[model samples]
Target: MLDRAGYDRYLAAFNARDYDGVADFYVDPPHMEFFGIVITSRQELKDFYAWLHDNVEENVRVLNFAASETCTAIDAIVRITAKKDLTRAALDAKGATGFFPITAGVVQEIRQFIFYTTRGGRIEKVECALPPMALETV
Candidate 1:
């Protein structure tokens, strides 16, 4: 069974932008699905995170969470501040508003639903659902 403390630790690690710490919560070769893109290897996951860290600054606030014997689901609001201009294609792919141009330092809030399946107390698989971006005027 997934414990709340364990989940909290994961969240804390993630919010700290500690990729290595976050990776420790997952099994090697973890499976992840995000915005219809599937990442099956740990190396790929690390690379993806590296790219994200380089592109934007982000923080997540969990609004709700539920856990069962094998699965945990989290509903969160992710605030992202772009460090560079985001292309329309990239915005559209993430279900974000494509009409508004995303320039540097623009904050975008994304409602996210994330589900995790665990084995031996480590995350085995992750599936994430992201809605369209809601840009907040600073």
Candidate 2:
């Protein structure tokens, strides 16, 4: 089960971009699914988050969250700003920069739903659902 204090700690670690700290909340062989891509290991998740942090600065505002015995769901407004040049290929995968030019340093907002499953007080699975890229400003 996820308590408020535990969730707050996780949020703090994520907001701080502390990959290791965030990983500490997960159990071994943690699984994460984002945009249909599955990450099957804790180390891989940490690495992916590190890469994301390096490429973009992100801020998350939690609109609401609900917790059960084994699962927690969060609704959040996420803002991501490119810190450096994003490759054409990267933008293409996101289905952005095709119709509208999304150059580097552009800020985008996304409404996201994140679901977490916990076991023995450690997160065991995470699934993230996001809408299409809604460029707030480019």
Candidate 3:
């Protein structure tokens, strides 16, 4: 097994919104996650983080996360809770109020499943399965 303590520190840094700390986890080519999009490459990853930090107002606060590194893959189940400051700056440019919500406290308790393919000790790629969406079927 990998050093659980070290891994915990890594995870804690991520939960703390320490982008640089999370950046350190990537060695060779890095993978970037922007909402539902993925971009690979160092410079692209940096740009992705910059945009994410600038535009996304939500924070990923991990309630709990447990990860296991197998011979060829890493599996993790993370419980994440989030709060978003939904701003209307973009909408305001088009003349719209900042106040609109179907209900208060839109916080979501989501279970995220992350699977990673590994080469040597570094993670190569990741696949994620998130909680179901709230939209009704047509």
Candidate 4:
């Protein structure tokens, strides 16, 4: 089970743009889903982040975090600053789009509800949800 501190370290590594360090918190074959894209291998996870970081700087700020024996949940804000222009065509070619419209030199942020399933203190799967309209104002 990953405790608060362990999760904090993972967030630290991620916000620091330390891809390798962030990968250390996951199981060998990580299963991560974000914005409808599924990554089922460590190399894919690395590659995804690498490609994303190449175009923008991303950071997550946790508003709330909770962990139990097998699962962890978080309410977070994802901030992205685009380093280069990413047109819809380009994003579509990559099979995805920015969380919001992104223009070079622009900053965008959004709230996300994320869940993680862990095994042996390592993350095995992750999924994210958007806040419902009812809770968006809160």
Candidate 5:
């Protein structure tokens, strides 16, 4: 059985770009990275994640979800629910490592993610890999 509730909460914080909440989800700062860019410190990781959320033009909504081996993967469709008109100023003010295009429909995006967890215990680390959007070609 999958711990859907717990997974949902974790993803909620992640989707909201609550870097502090995300950090607290981890126990000892489990390794996290994006295309090989490693994140170690909680503050550094939070800053990195915050930058990502600020840059991105969309948010996620869980469509199909699953969990295995302490990892919770979700296949969800992202909607560009909103776009900041002041994006230019925001970017100029803070900047970002990278940003993504707001897509339509339920594209198959599997959130390959892992969390440090134990029975009746809090997670020690949380990491996720959001691979490039992949939709069925056929």
Candidate 6:
């Protein structure tokens, strides 16, 4: 089970772009589902973030959080600064789920609900979703 302290550390690692530290919080075969795209292993998670980092800088700020023995749920604001233009067509072609129009040097913010299922203090699965009307200029 992941407690609040552990989850906080995970967020810190992520916000710092410590990819290996972030991966260490997950199980060996962790599952991640972002919208319709799915990542079923830790290596894929690392690769996905690496690719995403190349295109944009992302930071997540938690608005609310709750944790139980098995699950952790979070409401957060995700801020993304585009390092290079990411067009809708290009993202679609690459199956990059949960991404929107991003013009180089522009910033966008959106609200999301993220859930993680934990086992033995490591994340076993993660799922994320947007609230209706989630996108707004910051």
C-alpha lDDT of all candidate models, in order: 0.77, 0.77, 0.46, 0.82, 0.51, 0.87
TM per prediction = 0.81, 0.83, 0.53, 0.89, 0.55, 0.94
State the lDDT of candidate 2 residue by residue for 6-25, as single tens digits: 89899999999888889889
- For residues 1-138, could you state the per-residue lDDT of candidate 6 as single tens digits? 787789899989998878899999998988887855678887888888888888999999999999888899999999999999999887877677557878999988999999999888889999888889898866
Deviation in Å, model 4, residue 8 alpha carbon: 1.0
lDDT of 4 by residue, 25-89 (tens): 99988998776567888788888888888999888889999999999899998778889987877
Estimate, for each residue in 12-108, the C-alpha lDDT of model 3 and write its tens digit. 7666767666665665686634235565865655555554444333333344445456322223433322233434554244232322221223443
Better of 1 and 4 by lDDT: 4
Best by TM-score: 6
Alpha-carbon RMSD to native, per candidate: 3.6, 3.7, 7.5, 3.0, 6.3, 1.2
TM value for model 5: 0.55
lDDT by residue (66-120, candidate 1, tens digit) is 8887898888887788898878777566544423446788887777788899888
- Lowest-lDDT window of 10 residues in candidate 4? 129-138
Give residue 19's lDDT in candidate 3 (0 to 100).
66
TM-score of 1: 0.81
Query: What TM-score quantifies how close candidate 3 is to the native fold?
Result: 0.53
lDDT of model 5 at position 67: 60
Those runs of model 3 whose alpha carbons end farther than 4 Å from true positions after fitting are 1-3, 32-35, 46-50, 53-105, 131-138
- Cα displacement (angstroms), candidate 2, residue 117, comes to 1.3
Q: How does residue 35 of candidate 5 score in lDDT?
A: 39
